[model samples]
Target: MSTSLKIYDTTLRDGTQGEGISFSVTDKLLIAQKLDQFGVDYIEGGFPGSNPRDISFFAEAKKLKLTHAKLAAFGATRRAGVKPEEDAQLRTLIESEMPVLTIVGKTWLMHVHEILRTTPEENLAMIEDSVRYLVAQGREVIYDAEHFFDGYLDNSDYALRTLEAAARGGASNLTLCETNGGKLVPEVHKIAAAAVARFGRDKVGVHCHNDSGLGVAVTLAGVDAGASLVQGTMNGYGERVGNANLVTLLPNLFLKMGRTANCAKNLKELRDLSLFFDELANLRPNPKAPFVGQSAFAHKGGLHANAAQKVARSYEHIDPALVGNRTRVLVSDMAGRTSLTLKARELGIELDERLPAMKGLIDELKEREFRGYEYEAADASFRLLIAKWLGQQKTFFDVENYRVIIERHNNQIWSEATVKLTVNGEAMHTVAEASGPVGALDKALRLALAKAYPQLQTMSLRDYKVRILESNQGAGSRTRVLIESGNGKKIWGTVGVSDNIIDASWEALRDSVEYMLMQS
Candidate 1:
């Protein structure tokens, strides 16, 4: 039978230590519920004594009815000479009323001597005293031997004694922490194996960081070395270079390593879980992240796309569906007929590569891209192009002409635009004013179509990006504009390029409206 591993998530505690990561009490509560739903074994709430946000989170979290994950509170072991019962931090931990308590204690003799200003034996006593007191209070104490790997290298005997002390004091698990995050995979495997032999497999856990860029590797190595518990943060968020990524580690443990975890059965929710964290963090998801990334299973090259079209395994490692992700065929200038065919199929469009129109479309795509059109980032534009080539594109409206004027008077500037278009063979002219030329144009255009297409009212421009194609040309440089629009339901991207910035913006804005109408 595969060894059942305990997945101890420190995302709420340690993950908040990462730069640019901050969560409100409600955010913490929501994430805890999500982790429980995802089937993680433990959720480490933050240090209650550190900040009111964490204290508030613990208070609110106690009311949350988490289904699977046991709520764990994180803190350091009682101070150098302080008794556990008298320690304010320890008292706060107990007041938080969490069932599982993880207390990090100094494992390195240098920390004991220099940092704690205490003797090696005194540090051992502190670890024992803290763990014993917590256990006596009916808490399942998990002792985090901070800097265990580095301390073990410094003085193996003293490090082994630290674990023995925690064990004697009733620590349910002895977690060997690679605090510096600089330990190699081999070193972690060897040290973790030795610790497991000394303290039994079920009693030893591993916590690693990613300073060496091997947090995931070393974590897997620890598991390989018979550690039964794994501790890390989701999305690799932590202090410094971050902790071993449970987002990356969970799949490795359950799928690649054939290990059983409480979360193993909910493996299909992996991508959603990763995305959920990114969304809450307000950080753009890493497109290149393994397993759950947008580009993880995206095929771009012609040959690669062709092979993937014939046999998915030719380009993909495992079935993306296993992790709730799907393969994407990116359409680019380098795309072959097979690539276009696959891309078309992905978009729910029927395009037979053997058709003569396929060759023309490919040639046109290359020519357009050579002229600074990027289809990959503009899916809506690409779909429109396919429709035009296939003679299936609808002509909802036709623009006769558009004019934009900017005026600066009395230190105030304003832009006005006039648009003339025909909707269903009826001439329509509209004029509007805004703060910028693009904004003016958008207002005028929408005014012209408001009555004809009320659906465009909910659709508004969400984002606009402009890139100069040729910097050397300076004032005469060709500009590419990308616009993202949302109709309160789905979002789509469109692109346009021209020598004039206004022209480029107009092209993108027009395409955005056309794409929305086409869909409607």
Candidate 2:
């Protein structure tokens, strides 16, 4: 196996094939820049000939002063009868002016005969001619043998011949693509090993999808079989169960497998890069994702938390800080005093387990959890509860009363809220209107308190999530509201639960404001 592997990222091109995943020209350019900064060897921009958006992206991407990473333009092999120079797609690849050209050609004889309706000889000619033409045009060609694994299974001789054809055409690398994403690790290792033996390790690569949930596994298998280049997308964004997840694969390679890459120096930035992609994609981050997820190092069980607090390695496989994540102690009904103490320490609070109040705090926390208050994601609310129970919290203000009104006028619905609150023995009243009741309430509360606390101006609701508990009760089910608030530099979560959704939301909203005041 190679000591160092080339990391080729196709998130902008192949990842867009995923449902609900699309990037504007600017988004693609931003991702390319980030990938370069993260030490990627190659960033595959979209197919320039396929879409105007991708063509525009390449035009704009050329303006970027990338520190690392060569841009690769993706396209298919030339049409069966067309000369490479006259092929429109090949010409577009040249016009994109990317440093590298990735051409995907059919490896499966079935696809050659049926999909292209061309003879086997012509198919081989197409692969060789397209690569030879691109190489002659001053482009470094990486030929992707699409469906290479399936083709090798059906006709090993023809599949090997396809790779040889690309090799004969001056291609720098031959990437075996598990396009269908159905091959298991063993077979993938066997086929990839054979390719490595034939083409040499430096000239072999692997591209895999996750249909069988083996994308990452098979990618590792390929590396074990001596493939030197690994092709994947971040967060596994691709069509039908997605592609190999580089976010997961990189750690396995550099950390677990003892391999090296240029990006290994920035391994700690993995989580931030993952989050940046999620933000640009306008998708929620997966809390359960491995290595970088919120829950990746979270300890909830009393025994687990206790052991983890005593010895970090007792429960954790690796140091969370190695990947820019931290150990999280989740306090729940199952938590012991040790878990509570660890959680308090996580919040920068010192709690003595010997104190009689410690047991009381644990009991109160369990009782709150029984009432459907989850603190795992609502650290602010839990901190407030601790402060109140310890008799150290000061009341910033008292809510006298609040009311919301929803009315339909001129065929448009509007919501209005009135908030009455007392700050330092002085009563203040404010009214605000918005498109929804929650928005109106938020505006009204801010208006009422803005004068008393100027910091309230910086605080705004970032996210609001509502969950219905006890489905059998239907409309009367208890609602849990979790609100996330931020003040430019800091963010916190607060949670509330009640039979009435409005009341639950108000509880969470109130807690958010109180937590901010407490910290301030």
Pick the TM-score winner.
Answer: 2
| Pairs that clash in candidate 2 | none
lDDT of 2 at 75: 93
Q: Rate the local accuracy (lDDT) of all candidates.
A: 0.92, 0.93
Assess candidate 2 and give its TM-score to the true structure: 0.98
- Candidate 1: residue pairs that collide: none
Query: TM-score for each prediction?
Result: 0.96, 0.98
Query: Cα deviation in Å at residue 95, candidate 2?
Result: 2.1
The superposed Cα distance between candidate 2 and the true structure at residue 508, in angstroms, equals: 0.4
Per-model C-alpha RMSD: 1.7, 1.3
